[model samples]
Target: MGELDTFTDALDYPVYVVTTAAGERMAGCLVGFASQCSMDPPRFMVWLSKANRTYRVARDASHLAVHTLRDDQRDTAELFGGRTGDEIDKFEHIGWRWPTAAGAATAPVLDDVSAWFLGRVEGRVDGGDHVGFLLSPVAESPAGPVRPPLLLLSDVVDLSPGHPA
Candidate 1:
């Protein structure tokens, strides 16, 4: 083996919540393993840990909603990132609403988001610990009047998982 990098070191990137509108609302922890993969076609990719409950829901989701948190929205990040939706209804506590885009799924759009994008899952590929989802943006918008600083991995250091890994 070459070497093993600590997950902490490997995960030091902007965190986000990847959500889906299947039967029920679901969301999960996503480190910075996402990026704009295309320009002309307008595509983005997000990698969700296979071990995550959100991935299970997302696998069947028609649309995945991507939300960026404001620095003040760390609480929201912690709830989604550190906890599993398998045992809890995260939407109960978060302020959210459904998108108006045509053919939009039942995913929740965080009300306090800094920015958001609703993408259709164009493709999916297994990436070992995580599954990579290629999303083609169909709808997007800024969340609030004031742009907020994005919450990063460094901001949510104290939160621990509420579900068994």
Candidate 2:
């Protein structure tokens, strides 16, 4: 078990902020468990913790907006990942805009990012403590080499989770 922890910690991957809105509520959270699950149809998956406030909003959301932050953009990660949306509105402190009805439904799109993609929710999988939301790409902004370096777990390891494990 200790070795598994060590092995997993050794792998550095990009961290993402996933946002969703439903009814009159909006929520977003820092996400690390996400990946491309399909190629032909271009499907993506994002895992939201059961303890996160964003998960509640995403459960019935039609679409989700995922963003990749840069190394210099740790503040965005801290805002979304280190604080509880139940107590504060994450968008009020960040540079964000609501999506058009034809866009990503009520999802908030963060303008401060290296890249972003809007995905339509296809289905949900009950994966133990976390639920997996399958997404089909609706719109995407490709990142270039000139953009900031990808944010990683090591960058956010120092911060404490707003919602306890």
Candidate 2 has an lDDT of 0.88
The digit string of per-residue lDDT tens for model 1 on 18-108 reads 7786775466554557888899989999988777778888888878888887778878877787777777788887888788873555566
The RMSD of every model to the true structure, in order and in angstroms, is 2.7, 1.9
The TM-score that candidate 1 achieves is: 0.85
TM-score of each: 0.85, 0.92
Model 1 misplaced regions, further than 4 Å: 1-12, 28-30, 143-146, 163-165
Clashing pairs in 2: none
lDDT values for all models: 0.77, 0.88
- Output the worst ten-in-a-row residue range by lDDT, candidate 2: 97-106
- Model 2 residue 82 lDDT? 95
Q: Among all windows of ten consecutive residues in candidate 1, which has the lowest summed lDDT?
A: 1-10
**Cα-based lDDT at residue 36, candidate 1:** 88
lDDT of 2 by residue, 1-165 (tens): 765798797888999999999998999999989999999989999999999999999987998999999899899999989999999999889888775534435578898799888888999999878999999877777557696778998899888989974
